[model samples]
Target: MLLALDLLGIFVFAISGGLVAVRNQLDIVGVVVLAMATGLGGGVIRDVLIGAVPPPALDDWRYLAVPAGAGLVTFLWHPAVERLERVMNVFDAAGLGMFCVAGALKAHDYGLGPAPAAALGMLTGIGGGVIRDLLAGRVPVVLRSGELYAIPALAGAAVAATGVELGVRPAVVVVPGAVLASGWRLLAFRKGWTAPAPRVSPPR
Candidate 1:
């Protein structure tokens, strides 16, 4: 079940990256590159950090297919895809949630402690978007002034990891934990919630 969610999350993030390429007026090659980057960027980083030699995405060719397929779909159905931007956040949130669980779990499996696992979970959640944005010549949204982006993923990862340590039904615990993170993201978006920036005055 966790594996399935991980795959689904990858697919969704790939589609989003592809859609972004479309929005950016990128060429076919650019779309494909962006799709793969956004989809696998975070997971690959997490795996490497956890010492999953060769990385699952690299070892399993299907991982490559998922993102490439997503990019193709975006290319073929651009108008329909464009219309789905509102729904994109929901999928993106889900992706964040799932990746957080997956990353933290992988870290724990590799014998990393709670602190590092939670941190890796946070990276696994947002690293892809950061790569995608950088490739597109824009600052990543998580780095920008936005609603609670990494926080939800962080919360979810921590919850899932703690559950794992407690011998909870990891599958059951993670699903709801992911959902919780997703809910937080969407709610933050809806509420226009954001962290406060420091006060600035006009230059003299």
Candidate 2:
């Protein structure tokens, strides 16, 4: 189940990266490279932080293949893919939820406390997007757009970490954690909600 979720997240994120690369007028090589980077960047960061050397993304052929395939598909069918932007957004939310929950659980397994685990979890959810934006020469959406992205990831990670700390079965906590993050993200998108922004005074 964990592996499946990770692969799903990677595939979806890779497609997103490919789309961004295409929109930025990148070559096919750039599209594939960006896709692979976005797909694996977050998990690699989490693994390195936890001292899990040679992260599964590096070790597993399937992990490498999935993102490469996604990138190719996106490059070939981008117009169709672009037409399904809303559907892609839904998949992106699912990817965020899965990554956050999985990252937190992995951190906990590595002896991290709830707070640290939750922090890493949120990183796992947003790190790929950050790298994607950077590679595409844009400011990361999570950092600049005031979208309800990181908060929901943190919320989901917190729920999973706290539940496990309190002795809940890992399997049992997965759904609620994932649902909270993804559902909240979907709601925010649907409602045109934005995170709170600071008010600025007008220049004299």
Candidate 3:
């Protein structure tokens, strides 16, 4: 179940990266590179942080194949994919929810404390997007756009970590955490809710 969720998240994030590449007029190679990086980067970072060296994303062929396939599909049918931008955003929210919960669970399994596990989970959700934006030569949307992206990830991670700390079964814990994050993200999108931004004083 965990592996399945991870792969699903990878596919969604890969498509997002591929779309960014297309929008930037990148070639096939660039599209594929961005897709792979965006899909696998976060998990790889989490794995390394928790001493799960070699990262399943690097060791497993399935992980590599999923993102590569997503990249190719996006490269070939970008117009159709781009046409579904709003729908894709919905999927992206789901991916974020799953990724964060999964990350927190993995960290807990590795004996990390709840706080660190939750932090890693949030990172696992947003790290890939940050890498994609940087590679695409743009500020990461999570940092600049003030979208309710990372906060929901952190919230979901916190929920999962809290559940595990209370001795809950991982399978049971997954649903509510994921739902909370994804549901909140979808609502934020529909309602135009954003993170609070700093108020800059007008120049004299």
Q: Which candidate number would show the highest lDDT if scored against the true structure?
A: 3
Q: Give the TM-score of candidate 2.
A: 0.96
Candidate 3's displacement at residue 39, Å, is 1.0
Per-prediction TM-score: 0.91, 0.96, 0.96
- Steric clashes per prediction: 0, 0, 0
Estimate the TM-score for candidate 1: 0.91
Q: Residue 24 CA error for candidate 1 (Å)?
A: 2.1
Local accuracy of candidate 2 as per-residue lDDT tens digits, 1-204? 767878988999999999999999999998998999899888889999999888988888999999999899999999998898888899899999999999999999999999999999999999988999999999998997988999999999999999898889989888999999999999999998999888887989
Q: Indicate whether candidate 1 or candidate 3 has the larger TM-score.
A: 3
lDDT tens readout by residue for model 3, 1-204: 767877888999999999999999999999999999899888889999999989888788999999999999999999999888888888899999999999999999999999999999999999999999999999998898988999999999999999999999998899999999999999999999999999999999
For model 3, the stretches where C-alpha displacement exceeds 4 angstroms are none
Error of 3 at 84 (Å): 1.7
Error of 1 at 185 (Å): 0.8
**Clash pairs, model 3 backbone:** none
Once all C-alphas are superposed, what RMSD does model 1 give against the true structure? Answer: 1.8
lDDT of 1: 0.86
RMSD value for candidate 3: 1.2
Clashing pairs in 2: none
